[model samples]
Target chain A: NAGVTQTPKFRVLKTGQSMTLLCAQDMNHEYMYWYRQDPGMGLRLIHYSVGEGTTAKGEVPDGYNVSRLKKQNFLLGLESAAPSQTSVYFCASSYPGSQGKETQYFGPGTRLLVL
Target chain B: AQSVAQPEDQVNVAEGNPLTVKCTYSVSGNPYLFWYVQYPNRGLQFLLKYITGDNLVKGSYGFEAEFNKSQTSFHLKKPSALVSDSALYFCAVRDSSTPGYSSASKIIFGSGTRLSIRP
Candidate 1:
């Protein structure tokens, strides 16, 4: 099983340009999340979804939006990319309840460079 | 708030020697700690976690972590290190006492530690 897969392993964007990052998980997880990894910031959540058709803000959600139209897919969109958005983005998914609470499978990560 | 700290920015150890990566965390209630490893340009892989029971939690790739409630630390250790063990290690924590599932269930990660096992 391709636990979690992200589209466009790498991308370059200019300030103000908009793009959507696609995240797909085949594990049939009930929770999905988007996080950005910076040099010294570890991983900061941008947005998350508890289930399909449900999305909520996270620690750093100001410049990002997300959609979980399907249980297996979660998409993060940068409406107006800024240089500050240049970072490694990761997608993760996990099952609900206590069983899978501590374990989250992550994607390879997408490296975004906003010029 | 919940937070995690990886004291060392990097650690160097000889292959075949024991290795330890220190991690400390702060949480209001019971802490669910975890360790994750990331290779160059790769995603994070779960190593092990401490929810309850044994303080010494063994995980993937021959990794183990001891949870110290009093010290509030979860340090990753390996009996003998391998060159392939050189990678970025992260320490994370989550508050298990949180009533129900929400964004509060999110795990907080430490800055990270670069572990280099020299051969």
Candidate 2:
């Protein structure tokens, strides 16, 4: 299985431009997450989906939106990209469990640069 | 609130020397600890985790971690360092008080520690 994969591995956008980052998983996980990695600031949660058709705000949800239209896909949208938002974005998936399935599987990551 | 800390900003070691990366955490309930490695221009990869039962947790790449409940620390360790092991390491924790199905089962991560091994 591919586990989890993210599309558009690299992208550049103007301050007002908008774009979407797509995350897909083959593991049939019930939970998905979007996180941004910045220098000296570990991964910060942006948004998350508990299951298909359900999404929630995370620690840093500003300037972004998320939709989980399909069980295997989770999409993160940048309404208006900003230089401050330029960071490596990572998507992860996992089964909602207490014993063994909580180990999150991460994607290769998508590098974004906003000017 | 639950949090994780990696006090060392960077750690350096010789190829054959033993290596240690320190990590500490605080949680309201039982903690599910994890260690992840990130190479340059790559995403974080799961190395190991400490859920329960064992005080010493073994993981991928011949690495291991010792969970010290009294100290609230889970330090990653290796018997011998390899130059190829140079990378960034992150420590994370999830508070077990939150139900597994809740969206608030957030995993908090440390800022990260850079490990460099010289041949």
Candidate 3:
């Protein structure tokens, strides 16, 4: 099974452009997350969803929005891209159960370049 | 507030030698700590985690980490370093009972540790 898949592996956009990054997981996990990786910032959370129809803000949610319309899909939307938004974005999912098991599976990632 | 710090920007070790990447965390209550490794231009991969049960937790790729409550640290360790082990390492922490984690959870990651194994 495809653990996690992110669409638009690479993209280049001029400033003020709009785009959406899609993430899908087949594990039926209840938790999904979006993160961006910069040179020295490591990975910073952008947005996340617990399940279908549920979404929440994360550590760095200023320039993005998210939707979890489907249980297996999470979408990140950039209303207006900027040079600061040029970074590798990752999508991840996890299963949190009664046993306190928290293992996150990640997608390859989308590399975006905003000029 | 929860946060993580990987003091060393880069660590170099000879192959076959024991390797250690340091990490420290700050959080209220019990912290669920985690270690993840990333290859060049790749997503972070889970290595191990420390919850309530044990201070030393073992995970994939012969990697392990020790949890020290007194020092508020969870450092990643490997008995022997390998060329393939060279990668970017991250430390993360979260409070299991934090209000922000009631639904979809978010984690704080350390700056990152670049481990290089010299032949």
lDDT of each: 0.91, 0.92, 0.89
Residues B1-119, candidate 1: write the lDDT tens digits: 88899999999999999999999999898888989999998999999999899899999999999999999999999999999999999999988776766634468999999999999
The TM-score values for the models, in the order shown, are: 0.97, 0.96, 0.95
Considering TM-score, where higher is better, how would the candidates rank from best to worst?
1, 2, 3
lDDT of 3 by residue, B4-73 (tens): 8999999999999999999999987788888999998778889998888878899889999999999999
Best by TM-score: 1
TM-score of chain B of 1: 0.96
The best candidate by DockQ is 1
Better of 2 and 3 by TM-score: 2
List runs of model 3 lying over 4 Å from the truth: A98-101, B99-103
Roughly what TM-score does model 1 have, to 2 decimal places?
Answer: 0.97
lDDT of 2 by residue, B1-119 (tens): 88999999999999999999999999998888999999987778999999889899999999999999999999999999999999999999988776645524478989999999999
Ranking by DockQ: 1, 3, 2
Cα error, candidate 1, residue A21 (Å): 0.2
Interface RMSD of each: 2.1, 2.5, 2.7
> For model 3, how does the per-residue alpha-carbon lDDT over A1-115 read when each residue is reduced to its tens digit?
9899999999999999999999999999988999999988888888888779989888789989999999999999999999999999999999867323487888999999999
Candidate 2 regions off by >4 Å? A99-101, B103-105
